[model samples]
Target: MDHRTQLEERIAHLTRHVDELSEVVARQQSELDRLSRRVAMLMAREAERELDTGGSIPLADQKPPHW
Candidate 1:
């Protein structure tokens, strides 16, 4: 094959690879976003449960041991 033809083939192959990688990255981003939201929801629920039980005051409001 001619040099020009070989270069064209290589370009096409690289383009296809780049497109596949982009799709994989997009899928991973979506999954990460979903997991983040789920974690936030779980944390909120736990905080509410703590309040209901009156287990303890929030950490920031408590006095240090030395006080």
Candidate 2:
């Protein structure tokens, strides 16, 4: 094939690869956002639970038995 044709093919391949990577990144970002919201909700629930229990120190903040 001619040099110009080879360059065009390479460009097409690279463009497709970039597009695929962009899709993956977009999916990962969506997943991250979902996980972040879930974490925040869990934290809020835990805080509410702590308040209900009269403001006890959260278990997560306590030192382990081995400590």
For 1-67, candidate 2 gives per-residue lDDT tens digits of 9999999999999999999999999999999999999988898788779878988877655789999
Model 2 CA deviation exceeding 4 Å by range: 56-67
lDDT of 2: 0.90
1-67 per-residue lDDT for model 1 (tens digits) = 9999999999999999999999999999999999999988887777677778895764444579999
All candidates: CA RMSD (Å): 4.7, 2.5
lDDT of each: 0.86, 0.90
Steric collisions counted per model: 0, 0
Quote model 2's TM-score: 0.81
Error of 1 at 59 (Å): 7.3
